[model samples]
Target: MSAPADSSALLQTPLNALHLELGARMVPFAGYSMPVQYPEGLMAEHHHTRRSAGLFDVSHMGQLLLSGPDAAAAFESLMPVDVIGLGVNKQRYGLLLNDAGGIIDDLMFVNRGDHIYVVVNGACKHGDLAHIQARIGGRCTITPQFDRALLALQGPLAVSALQRLLPGVENLVFMTGHGFNWNGADLYVTRSGYTGEDGFEISVPAASADAFARALLAQPEVKPIGLGARNSLRLEAGLCLYGNDIDTTTTPVEAALNWAMQKVRRTGGERAGGFPGADVVLAQLDGTRPLMRKRVGLVALERVPVREHVELQSLDGAKIGEVTSGLLGPSADKPVAMGYVSPELAAAGTRVNALVRGKAVPMEVAPMPFVPNRYYRG
Candidate 1:
């Protein structure tokens, strides 16, 4: 999460009042007054979501629609992902890149047949909108749906709770979505989320968000989750948080996100090299350019919580890297972190030290998803 801005100037989501009513400890995040945790506390919320369903008010995220015959091709030019090849109703995680191959922001886009729907980070929305408009607005009609409220119903039992409210939602496998009607409100729901769990992200009308959230909370398996648990959950899932783990300075290849780029966008494919920084990204992918550092997962041998910005050093005390995100993963029952390290030291089982208050805390590079991802593919 970004640093707390001026609380007085923070924007309020449609569920703000409901959050207050539920005794949430509000904090300023991404320019919004968001719930950090409710009366049940962060640990409870975290465990609850892991065991059942957790509802998150992600309405702060920017939602947009790009229409016209050129929408797909136009969007494809902004990122390495194969937007043109995306089938209708399919959703894909994407990175918006700059000319130098650094990530501008990470986003999710869905093929809506007539229009391409895009959702961007809350903190980067304004700039993202401007960037897309300036780059592809002439090729496609860009419509920003900032008024929409987005809710993520996530966990092992997420589908059970949501399907009860909106029948047929269970039919949406991971990475797919469809439009639905809920109590006279139109909703576009995708069976996807940041928490690496089988979940659904519902785009509901802002006006009806309160009632919708309350209804979901009424379900025995569903509970309100806050940003605190959301962060830990994503960290445990090995998912990168936009500003924390990725930013304008991080390239997709160096960030270990090569899988997000399809073959069509790689060097030998038909539609390769049209995106911003395509040369740089593709070179890193094909090994024509050497990477200085690589993102890797780390698990502390001790129980100490290693946090972001903590310096990581080699066994011999040579500075090797810095932690980008870390915590005592509630689910993993151990302290885990992700950071960039010298390429030679990025392999799993490589031992390192996280300097906490000048003490060397031993940590070993490990495979990610500190907790195994439970995405429903069937």
Candidate 2:
């Protein structure tokens, strides 16, 4: 795992002590001293999550709450997602955009009945907080839950393991969340995760985080995983990593995230073109503006492991784009990647080459979710 140059200034999560006790290799990530892998190794941890359940400590991410009668409507004005139309106890993927339609950050927001619960990437939490407060602070009250700890139990057996501790959790379908009580602690759990698996992400108070993690780890089907496996898992699922795949320079249309924008928010819908960059985004959606580049999935024809920043080129050697994320997928058992390319070359089965170490490695544009998603939507 690559870490920042200066690791001394990193913050520690509530589970830091437990991670050390469990023999995890700590590394600097997003200003935190996080576990990159455990003694079981990245490969083992990656496979464990695919076959059974793997517990992850994601406390470094930001959690916040927006409360007010106007919270939903005010929040909807910041992004293209239909926050006002979202049902209570349901969640939706959202993008925070700048005036030019470039993605400022990508996050998940859940309507918790009384308030909106938001989770942002650890690296961008501070910025996201200020952005939200500055844009919609007048319409709603913003509260940051930075002290809470989050845990993800992801895999095929995740439901069975989690239900033993919280009996009714199995009833929550994908993209939904519910408040629950566990051993006198207030918990907010959502049936969603970065990995394309049946999973749940639980938000517990910082004080009880260690105890809660231990309890979940005690389940026979659960094992501790780290950031290394987490990246590979999400990559196999074709999910975007904020800074890597999408950033302040990328737009929703260019990133192939049109599905995240509902019809109600699009042009001709009841509430159209109110959010930041709506003019640019709506134009791209309606085919008025042409796209120069687009994000696409790629599979290497050779056994070589293509990595990020590798230049993508046409069959005859014209530079088209570059890889944003790539790895030899542990489950897909091949080199898979997500990158940007000329719109004309973004289709599946389109042949291309990845310039790795001055050599041209053959590749083909492929459909995303390199592996099939196993989300329990029902």
lDDT of candidates 1 onward, in order: 0.94, 0.95
Can you write out model 1's per-residue Cα lDDT over 207-308, one digit (the tens) per residue?
889999999999999999999999999999999998888889889999999999988888676698889998888889989999988999999999999999
lDDT string for model 2 (1-378, tens) is: 234758777888999999999999998988899999999999999999999999999998999999999999999999999999899999999999999999999999999999999999999999999999999999999999999999999999999999999999999999999999999999999999999989999999999999999999999999999999999999999999988999999999999999999888996766887899988999999889999899999999999999999999999999999999999999999999999999999999999999999999999999989999999999
Overall local distance difference test of candidate 2: 0.95
TM-score of 1: 0.99
Q: Which 10-residue window in model 2 sums to the lowest lDDT?
A: 1-10
Cα displacement (angstroms), candidate 2, residue 55, comes to: 0.4
Per-prediction TM-score, please?
Answer: 0.99, 0.99
